[model samples]
Every structure is written in structure tokens, then in C-alpha cells.
Target: MSDTEGVEAEVAGAEAYAEAVDVLGPFNGPVLLAPVTHNPNNGVTDGVWDVTAGDRAAVLKVLTRSKGTTGHWAASDDPRHWNYWRREADVHVSGLAQLWRPYGIRAPRLLACVERPDGDVALWLERVRGGPGTRWTVRQHVEHLRRLGVAQGAVGETADRPWLSRRFLREYIAGMTPGQELLDDDEAWRQPLVREHFPAGLRHDMVRLHHDRDWFLQIMESLPRAFCHLDMWPANVRSDGPGSALFDWAFAGDGALGEDLGNYLPDSVFDLFVPAARLPRYAAAAYEAYLHGLRESGWKGDEHLVRLAVCASAVKYDWLTGMMLARAGEAQVDYGGDRPVSPELRYRERGSTLAFLAGWASEARDLAPRLGFPEAPSGR
Candidate 1:
């Protein structure tokens, strides 16, 4: 069956629920299933459901190769593709997700990974109960970053897995087509939120950041490599017992030593989980804590190189400002929903984040020459 048809049938079928029970097992009563709302913009995910049978509970996630309505959301059959549709299932079935247990972080336990008669793959996972990362205090956020450092440091320069994503930053960034014309359009920038939060100076820096994208990518490639959870961010993590439980292994793959921390710090503020005002304080503390974790794991790399990678990693979001500008005239929505939100609030929060990332771009330029990668002649 085609992915679209399969998804429609599975969501309406009793067979899917029965299959869940068969895979999850030992239920005292019939399972109750309820559809869980998730980000609908991503085309590959068929559906997520909350499954419960008496005292037992699990999360059921269905994955498919559906392209949805946009070229950017298309999934790939290639194992190395950044959005390979089967990567998450493979991570669970092969127990690769559990590899970081010794370092105090782990993916939720996989109760079952079922290949359905249709094209979709169903994953039944443990329902971890804890405060979401969005609600985490600064101290908790730093500790999680430390644990992430320990885990990635321990996996330093390991043999590549065919199913693990490769060149993720480059490939993912290439998929975005942010509106360049909107960047310089005075009318677009004059939107109330943009005018107030994204000033002329910050806008120029962001444009420079976009211009230096290729240069930043080159520097990141030259840095020390590690196995990374490329989507490490507030929404995908939670406090679970003594350690943390990370979700969404779809983008797990190879990355520079400090890339995950780079992504995490900005992401925390981008979604307004942590306020943009705390970014500087969090950046300093998190970097130090991450380095401490790396040292604990016997990684003796130069601190400056790691710092370079962390700062240069801002290239991953170079398209964000233009994208935001393109959408500035539209009715704004909350991060995870279609619910209408005030454009003023949305732009204010994300504009601050863009300003911070623009600073990282400047820092990356300074750090590059010191590390022997001289700045390329600017095309701008």
C-alpha cells in the first residue's frame, strides 16, 4: 500500500490496535488508544497514539515514507539520508539507542518494533514520566548538556553506522529554501515584531551569517567528530529518574564535538522554553559543564577547537531569519500547534534568538583564523 493510504487505514483500523496489544503483550484488558497531537508539519510521521491497557501504558509512533505536500518534508530510502524513514526503527531494533546508558542518558525503552502489513512501521515505546525540558531550570539544563557531552565524548570518532545520518548539517541546511528577497525588503522587516526586536544591525549580521554558511560548514567538518543526537533540544528531552530520557532518534548521526550543545542552547530560547535573556549565562555555564563532562570521559581535545565547533555550528540556522521574514506577514501560530498566536510575541521571542545566533556567526569567524582555517574572501 502507498504511505498515504496506509496511514489513513491504520488510524481508522482495529487491526492496528490489536497488533499493538500483541506486540506490547500481557494486557489484562483490551487496550485503549487515543490519538496524540504532534507537529503536523513533518510529513514522515503517520501518527502518534497513547496506548493503555489496565496498568500498562506506552506511546505508539508510526513512521512512513510519505512526502506530504512539500518537497522539504520528503523522507529518503537511503540509509545515510538525514531523514531516512527507517532510521528510528533500526535504532530501536538494533539496541543502538541504549548505547549511552553508561553515560547517564538513554532513549526510551522500545517495547516493540513492528513491521505492519502496510508500509508503515509501528514503534511501541516506554511512557517516561517527568518534567519536559522546556520547564527545566537552568541547573537542570546544564546537567543535561553535561550528560550529552559525556555520551558524545565517549563515542568519539567511532566507526560509522550505515543507518546513522551523515553530513547531517550540510544536507539538512541544503533542504531549506529561505526567501532571500524578503531579507532586504523594508516592508517585511517593518512588521511590528520585526521592527521592534530585529534591528538593522542584527539583520546585517544575520545576512553575513547566511553568506558565510559554506565557510562555517567547512570548519565544522574539519573539527573532531562524534556520534550525536542531531535533534537534541528542549522538546525532545525529559528528566527520567537519575538520568535523562531523550526522544526522537530520527536525526541521530555524526556531528562535530560541540554541535549538539550548540543546537541545544539556541533551541531552548528559540521556542521560548527558556527566555532569550538567559542565553548568555546559559551559554557560558553549559560550555564549561560540557567540557567538564568531556574531560570525565577521557577526551583530551583542545578546548579552543571545541569552542570553534560550538560557535561555528550556528551555520545550521543561517536560513532561519529569511524564513522568518518570509512568514512574517502570515498569521502566527504556536510552535507545536496551529493555534493562533500573537505575531508580536512570536517575533519578539524568535528575533532575540536570531540576534544571539548572529553573534555566534561573528565569533566563528574570529575563531576560524586562530585555528588555521583562514576566512575565505567574502562574496558579499
Candidate 2:
């Protein structure tokens, strides 16, 4: 068969396997049977099956070639991208599992990595025992933040690929800004929302941000590097009680220690439907808990600097928000999951939330002296 035909056949085989597993039980009896759904909303690449047969329960994730590389898959063209994708999948599952198991951080236990006859990959994992019981409470979310902090600290210096280092974020921000016009033209659907939140003046600067790589690199070198989940939002985080399980580690890499902390605080606060007024209190507590975990994990640095680095990371997201908004008119906005991209659903409705974070940053700045950090630096 030609390579194209071979890949097509592989895709068909994967689908057939999924169907057979759902109808029957395990193929060989030791395995389980379950129906898997393709998560199109996120990336639409893989099918996620909720597999259960008696005491052994797991999620069987089947992947053929991806429509693109928001997640892991072999691209027939580029050998490097192919290697990077596969290496990442194997390393992330095994590495984080090894790192977190000792510290009691919850993650799916990796069962097996099955390479298909036609060069596709399937990852079988122990399913999370129980998902968060209801909508997460504010306190529960705060505790989850603390746990994430512990996990981050525990992940210190484990994987040291410099390409995934501080420079990666810096360069990414620089590259995306100039492409704003293309994004705006291609992704016009987001214009209303982007224009509503972002002023005209700032929008121009969005494109010019490509010129300011120096600031990004300066910030990068100053920040202490730690192992980051790189995708630590509420969705990837599952919880029961104060305990939580973190999944989806395709982007796991070394990053500034507080990157995930800043990412988590806003996500947990917003997604849990926490009251606006109470957000500050919860944030402060999560920040404190995260610092404590970092200290416990043997980090030797000025804690205040780390906090500032975390805040600046928010600026990175601010840049990303503009980019996504610019592309809102595109056929799909890639949110980097198993599903196809959709609208900026979370940020669209939560203007108040972003305002809250800005306010929290201002307050945090005022309290910086008392907290042993200098006043917030000024720049756009």
C-alpha cells in the first residue's frame, strides 16, 4: 500500500477496534471493553474510551495521525517533529508518574504504550477513580492550587531540555505578535469580543510586541526554572475532596516555577464560580501555600522574585488572548486539546474575572513591600 493508503487503513483499524471493544469486552479477556468518544471540541484527533471490566478500569486512548500537532502524533513528513512527539508522550507519562507518585500527587497510572502494526499509537491509562463530585467549591479549588504548588516544587529540575526552557516562551510571544494582522483577518469572528475588552491603542501594540524580545529574555533568565505541567488548568485537574489528579502532560516542560501557579489561580477562581469579592482571599492563600511547598522542595531563591515572575507570566497569557481573539474568525480556534477549536468561551463571558486579576495584581503590588518584593515594574 502507498503511505497514504496505509495511514487510512490504520485509522479504519483503530475505529474498528474501538467499536469492537465497546460491543464486546476485552479482546483477549485480560483487557476491558468500553466506548470511546472523539473529543472534537478540543482537537478531534484521538478517541477516549472509558474502559471497565470488573476491578480493572482504565481509559483507552487511540490515536492515528492527527489533523495537526496540538498533541502527539507522527507527521509523515518531518522526522524531527515525529521524534519529538513520540518522545514527549513516552517521557511525560513515565516521568511525571515517577516524580509525583512518591509525593502523593494524583495522576493516571500508565498501563501500556501499544504501537499498532500500522505505526499508530494507543495509550492505556488507569482511569481516575472518581471525578470531582460536584462543581468544585472555592476552598477545594484553593487546596488544589496548594497541591499543584507542591507538585511543581517536587518536579524540580527533573527534565532539563533547554528548548522547552525559558527561551521557548519568550520566542513564542515575540513570534505571535507580528502575525496579529493575519490572525485578525483570518479569525474575524473574535473581533467583537477582542475589541470590547482590548482598546484600539493596545491592539496595535499587540502586533509590535514582536520587537520586544529583550524584555522577555531578561525576565526569562531572572526566573528560577522548575518542572511545569505547562497545561495546569481546572479541566486537566480532577479532584475528590482536597485531593486532585492532574492529566494531559503533552506540553510538560521546564519553566519558571510560578508559571503553573499563576495559570492555576485564575483558572480555579473562575471555573469554580467563586464570588468576585472572595477571590482575593483565596488567591492570597493559594499563593502562600504554593510558596510554602516551594520552600519545602529545596528551592533557594528570593520568594518575592518568583511571585513577580508569576505575575509577568500573566502578561504572556494576555498576549495569547489577543492572538486567539485575532483568529476568532478562523474556521476553528485551536485550544490545544483532543477537540477542534471553538470560541473563546471562558474569557468571553468573564470580563469581570480578568478585571479582578488586574485588581489583584495591583493589590499584590501595593502589598509587595510588606511581602518582601519590590513594587511592580512598569511596561506594556
Best by lDDT: 1
lDDT of 2 at 331: 57
The backbone clash count of each candidate, in order, is 0, 14
| Residue range 5-107, candidate 2, lDDT tens digits | 1121112244445544654445453343444422343332355566544454566665455546442222322222212334334554555544665554666
Candidate 2 to truth, TM: 0.67
lDDT (Cα, tens digit) per residue for candidate 1, span 47-116:
7777767687788899988646467668788999888888999888887788888899998899888887
lDDT of each: 0.81, 0.53
Clashing pairs in 1: none
C-alpha root-mean-square deviation, candidate 1: 4.2
Residue 85 local lDDT, model 2? 35
Off by over 4 Å in 2: 1-45, 53-56, 63-84, 159-168, 171-179, 182-214, 240-242, 269-278, 298-300, 323-349, 356-380
lDDT of 2: 0.53
